[model samples]
Target chain A: MKNYFSSQFKLGILGGGQLGKMMLYDTRKYDIQTYVLDPSNEAPSKVACNHFTQGSLMDYETVLNFGRKVDVLTFEIESVNIDALETLEKEGIKVYPQPSVLRNIQDKGVQKDFYKKHNIPTASYEKYAFAKAVKESPQWLDNLPFIWKSCTGGYDGKGVSVVRTASDLDTLPEVPCIAEKMIPFKNELAVIVARNVSGEVKTYPVVEMEFHPEANQVEYVICPARIDETVAQKARDIAEKVSNAFGHVGLLAVEMFQTENDEILVNEVAPRPHNSGHYSIEGSFTNQFEQHLRAILDLPLGNTDSKVASVMVNLVGDEGYTGPVKYENIEHIMGMDGVTPHIYGKKETRPFRKMGHVTIVDHNIEKARTVAEKVKGSIKVIAQ
Target chain B: MKNYFSSQFKLGILGGGQLGKMMLYDTRKYDIQTYVLDPSNEAPSKVACNHFTQGSLMDYETVLNFGRKVDVLTFEIESVNIDALETLEKEGIKVYPQPSVLRNIQDKGVQKDFYKKHNIPTASYEKYAFAKAVKESPQWLDNLPFIWKSCTGGYDGKGVSVVRTASDLDTLPEVPCIAEKMIPFKNELAVIVARNVSGEVKTYPVVEMEFHPEANQVEYVICPARIDETVAQKARDIAEKVSNAFGHVGLLAVEMFQTENDEILVNEVAPRPHNSGHYSIEGSFTNQFEQHLRAILDLPLGNTDSKVASVMVNLVGDEGYTGPVKYENIEHIMGMDGVTPHIYGKKETRPFRKMGHVTIVDHNIEKARTVAEKVKGSIKVIAQ
Candidate 1:
């Protein structure tokens, strides 16, 4: 434990985004030296971490060289070069989530296959080399109005598409991909499970992910999802099973879809701290970032119980804004009871770029949700 | 704001004790580069801060030289030279708490007089320049028992004595101090008030301090003190008054006495993040550390509401332990729900040294209190 705190032990992280920036917060707390590698010079994580190295997380040599300077390796983003992690692991440096798990998760097709092999409940899907291959075989079009997801490097709706007709395929990038059967779901839910190397495990309460109808972006993440007790329990149990199967040594955010028929289908999983668990920061006993640190350090997992019902609204850049960013109405929102805005310290803004988030917690869940909606409507992250 | 974030803006902190260590948590969180000046190379804050400069906080030249390096200056320990802070303030560098407040608080006699002058409610006390002088003055000596406290550099239980009889004065330190008429109280309590340059102000819930009678150490600090609602409000009002008087631009932890008759008396105040507010890390909507940062930076102050009832138990060295430290049963205690231990990373252990603290949180305050007692009973920080 001493080795993990204020020592020469260095933890290398990939992707200096907001997640990385937040992760650096805990590392800084423990005085654990950290080196973060991201392509952007102005990455939000650059200032927070002890050492900020600007380089491609996907570049083979870049990651390998960065990995060599640290004791153990972990990542904030999954879109990293797995081969480099494997190389680091071979060289005796520990890489959490294991390169194997990242390899499976980095690709939609592989992640689906893993769920199937593990007998984990998930949506049925078929893999394709390209969009042309789907047209070649009409059988592949069994699910005509399906969800199209690029196998690799898909993030925040970039490599994802919804196909209403065959014509929708034209809008998607031609690459290795999966066409997931669009199962009608009553709600989107998530569970964050933390597991340490010493076998200590803890799961946060089920959180409901309410997505924007047009943008398909999660509008509010409400913890202690207002779902049936049995459904919530099942989702948590299934999430634990997935984490156990992956042998994850840190936080594993299990995103699931609650079908209208009450079946829980694994939507996807993110190996690092996920957006859905941001509510834990203000609402839960042990925040997800601190839990991630504890789990990775193999310390006993902390309690994940929420102290209050919470709703988290993401602060994304307003469309057409692309310069020094300003959070309008931030002061007004701060005046609201139980509202906390976490600015990621990103000076520049781009359309829909995640700059920060606001979490509203209250004893009454509905009140928190209402305030979150009001916050979503009033505040805007715009460029100066 | 960007200049404060990872720029060359260095914040020089005097005294690298636990409070300083915790303050560094926020500085690190905001990526505010900081330099810590303390006499001990193994100071608790030595690790977390960016730069650790070994120096005496009391020596004028030492403090002045250190103050010249940072953009803003502050201190955890009040024993720091006010002349140096005044010098720095005159030179255009910001010194939180202001030199005037420190000058008053540095001497216990002046502090008591200031309270009387302000017409603040406080226990009756007598000041003496030396222990012998108090023993010689039979007229000044009250028959009733009193608590003797040194005016300078006394921390924990050291330089403090309970004079029940004439023999008690024999062992007391011969230093300028105060002998206060002890008030019989159901509980000891404290309130932390935070203020900023923008005139923003906030107060944390009153916390009841449970003391170990034999050791004279605070065993647990329970937030939202299990007292009558009216008493809590009075304590908060008094705390706010004290903050206004100090004209401080940071956190002020006002220690107070709550009598069995439900009366409150001001004990003393620390103009920095105090131990009584540690539970904020786990329980409050906005932690005191972040609040202190916001106050100093003139950023919008966050909500100070508690999300759950929190109890903080200090981690001190067990009696007779004075060597390399080992936290026995740490894992066992951490295994319990809602138990969070913050090890300050101090490698050595001396009897009764304030090493770290554990925060237990629950929606049920009684349940959290019960767990805190168990935590206090089960763990031992001792010599290896």
Candidate 2:
């Protein structure tokens, strides 16, 4: 008579950002008891959870203390205290994605090495204990223009530099890092794979990530990617392989590059609900957030089929605005059929900050893409 | 801009039942601050809302006091204090479905009278000042068999009785009532029409109600009811007419009966989210819960078109199992594709009490209906 729904079976979530807020929607739906911890008192998920503990996720004591109080511990981000997670696992607490998986993923060097050792198709790369080593021996890069990524704490295009020239290497911070051979890829794609403790696995459809040409930031995520069926299948198979290789319990979003030769190569991975799958909220039979919970809880995985074609346009804060946030033309886009805008509840807007996103769905993929473009042009996330 | 999203502009909701819990999902998506009040401290919406207050919804002081704190107030239940709502409205607080609408709907006699006065087609019914009056003048009821309903406080299958003979009248409560002429309806149907404060209105697809032969309770609600197009259209038009007649803001669920001759007659009305529209949560582009919020907030109504066919099966507590609730065979049903169970978070389950609902969606109506049947037979809400 284990009662997870509407009982004292507490499920502690490690981060309380928009991803957690979205995940809480399913937890609330199932009446599953949830406790969330975050550094900010004003986290988007601060209100929806049954319990909210304001603490640092990186602090070993804070994470361990919180983990011991819950029956199962899962996180929305990989930046948490892995040592504390290992301790919690040793003490018989259930940690989804397992501490071992997080340990490898916590640093780019370990993640890339794991990929290489497992024969995962990723760009050939060399890891440096220090960024200065690459400068000290220019031959370490092998090529003129390599992608230099900091081994730790690189997120949302930060801590990643394109060494187009020798001076570009001088601009890089002196830290342990990896230099990946640049691939002239045609498109960036992502596949979210869900695996449970019992080993049941499922993968969502391939989604193409369209980047802002100038900023090189992902702007639109279109599901049922406008790629060849074989390519889509290849990407999904690769993602499932990654999930199996990691023995991950929960959602693992595998980002990949579709090389010019039609070959798919792994770019990186996020072991949580990813932005690329946000379209699932309105488009898929089972949303990624809910699927993540089902996987971690070992509940039966839901259907990952898309009910409609969709495109998700991220509502990054307008460059010139900062202060109280205002979603200009939000009502206008909401007037469009099948357009849903998800506001992350952040009060103030800063330049290029992730403020919210809009999902446009339609039976016709082209039509959905067109509406998504229109939504992108109309809505402006600016401060009032 | 008032900045309702993530701002101090609060939405006060009365009655924190499953309906309120479902509405809170949308509020979370929009990041709208909400405050919910319910009598029980273990209300389903308690966890999701920004603030929760424990109080009797029908109390004048409680309703008035809660109403004063928020810019806009709405109730998911019809049993709230109409007098207090009127007072609040006069004191500058906005209450959707104004107190006048509730006053008309709070009594069966008044509601029926209003339906007749508005030229709405409905079964002919004779109202009596008391049950004794009907017993005294049996000839007033031309037919021997008719439906008996209490003038006030009747909900679900309660406070209503079927009178077949003089002996049947004796079993009735001695109170003000009405006897409706039994139409021998071919099917029971419901249409949820949403109207915004700006007078814009929309009607959801007609849903057929399949009542349990023994309990006489709604067993399943099948959307896009298996009826002729013109009949469905007629039902929808009638529903829209009812919504316009009431001039109500928010959702008004219009229950109707299709006569042997295919005439659609008004059965009753609920000026809030109703059980019949529950299937829309997974079927329609805009779920009824979200539509209700949009209507109350004067936001543009979303597309009510069905993205996929769906049928909803109620998960009522099994008779003779009245204690802590347990959803037996829940995992078996969850394993089925496109099956979604919504646990209502009611810790204690009484006989025939609504514990939750399961929605089955598929491209084919017949397939969804079949899965819904399997779901009904498989999952049991029993005492642990």
Candidate 3:
């Protein structure tokens, strides 16, 4: 009962990226005042937020100063200075998805260790102090085809690689890292769990991430993951358990893999709105951004059911294009039924850059998938 | 072809009210830069747009200056300076729902005349230069009860009244006005027609406005009106005809009356997004705001079909409350399934002031309606 809607309540968001931009839409809907911090002056959220500060999110003083100005604080990205968040928390500023939870999740090594401590099912992994340790250990040759992930600073497709050969270990960065046994998976699935300060919790329907046949990238995110009901239910249960373990407020998107034998193993989790839930903007009764707001505000959460099945395709910069962004054939995709493209307002696009996303929705999941394919094939993010 | 997305192209909007605020959401989604001008610095759209100017929308110089700064110009409210818009259009600034179309719809007398000229079905009405003309003519007494509407500068139930008694005529404002024969109607319906600059047109499903039995005010707006399919089709056809008659580029929300004989009579039309279509945000495949952007930009029009049944209840300020606004029991409504409230960000409350709106969407129309009633009965927009 803080009168958060259309009142003087200030919500400060760290890292004004695409996620923060989308979150601003909901804040605007509720007429809540918002301030955003990002290093770039042209951050996607700069225009939408009530105030925009250009500063490094990783700078302790910058983060602390921004946190002090708001009634409640949250972050769209995990790379923010956690020590500042702890200081703000000590001063009674409400920081959702608490700093402790972020501290645990910010490093892959700590996150994996937390999962093991909580008895959460995950791919077996070994934490290494540095990539040199794995290179020097001849015994590591036994676990040849493992996944090498930089313990910190890994994002998108960066800082992660598959070590199938001895030379692959040489290519690893000199940072704290983890090598996990690669579990063959049938499908990559995800569940977005929302938990409020009052302990109210809900999970969105399991979504399946369909990978490109040859590109080895996520091609489509289909809601209600064309999987067995039992598997989907198990995913939701596990996601809720993860939420409880973190005691985190706001949204937690838990990514997992469905093993060939049908075992569900957690891949990782983002304690904020994930790209996988971008489809919810048009697909769910309550979009993930709005749900995150509800969770952080401790208001009653909206229904998580989808009005129609949805499929989302990320619009990345086309290869060999690296200048002012141009969305080619965008109008062609716009003509397709139930297609909505969300441009992230990034003026420039480089190869594989996360430029935007398009969502296709229909009553029939198959029809939605078909239209999503057309949308994916037609629209290309290129240089002007 | 203009590369509006994340480009140099700018969209200018007059009257930064709730409609403009909602439209801003779509503009943000598309990363389309926008400039907004409103008389009040606290306009809901001020924070969201790329640039905001506090200036009178009806002032010729103010509107012209703002319009000159952008490639295209539009308005959320109809009372903007049309002469300025005409000048901008002549200067090659695309003004959507065209300045000419807005000119016709801006005045009640001219709008009614255009309907007659275009052979559109509408209520029989007589235009008078002044209220004194109707008062001095005793023969008007024979007409008895009728609807009195001011020819210009009327909005949100203001400047419109039911003239049933002699004193009611005295209460009328001394201005250009219209007297329409009251036609007993079964339901007041609306159809939102979207027409792009290229002349591509589409219509949303008819929505029925259910009024409060005693208050005689619209209480709920239900989509896919619970009427015969033939009647609904007629309403849509008439709306399209109205859109075609104006050759309007953008959204024209045609409000109609489904008469006792199932005839559809055009009551009026809004050349921009209207309150009746607010439910589309949660119900339709593409909401009206996004559709308006597509039409104005001349991009392909989106699907207008509803994904689920929806009922919208306007959250007007409670009687006898006129200070800082507080939404009582809003949390109760938020707890309801499929309920989403959109606060307009107006800080003050006056009797019957439109503070916000709540939309309830469900797979079943009846269930949505039931939830809408619960939402209406629970939330009260009042002063703290």
* Top-DockQ candidate index: 3
Q: Write the per-residue lDDT of candidate 1 for residues B165-244, one digit (tens) a residue.
A: 87778778788988888788887899999998788999999999988776778889998899899999999999999888
Better of 2 and 3 by DockQ: 3
Model 2: residues with Cα > 4 Å off, grouped in runs: A136-142, B139-142
TM-score of chain B of each: 0.96, 0.98, 0.97
Stronger candidate by lDDT (1 vs 3): 3
Residues A299-332, model 1: lDDT tens digits? 7888888889999998888988898777777766
* Descending-lDDT candidate ranking: 3, 2, 1
lDDT of 2 at B293: 83
Residue-level lDDT of model 3, residues B1-384, one tens digit each, is 758898999999898899999999999999999999999988988889989999998899999999999998889999889999999999988899789998899999999999999999999888998776777656566878888899998877778878887788887788999888898999999999999988899999999998656445578999989999999998999999998899999999999999999999999999999999999999998899999999999999999999999999998888899999999888888899999999998899998888889999999999999988898888988898
The weakest ten consecutive residues by lDDT in model 3 chain A span A210-219
Clashing pairs in 3: none
Model 2's alpha-carbon lDDT is 0.90
| TM-score of candidate 1 to 2 decimals | 0.90
Candidate 3 ranges with C-alpha deviation above 4 Å: A135-139, A212-217, B135-140, B212-217
Rank by DockQ, descending? 3, 2, 1
Q: How well docked is model 3, in DockQ terms? A: 0.85
lDDT of 2 by residue, B233-266 (tens): 9999999988888999999999999999999999
Q: What is each candidate's DockQ, to 2 decimals?
A: 0.32, 0.74, 0.85
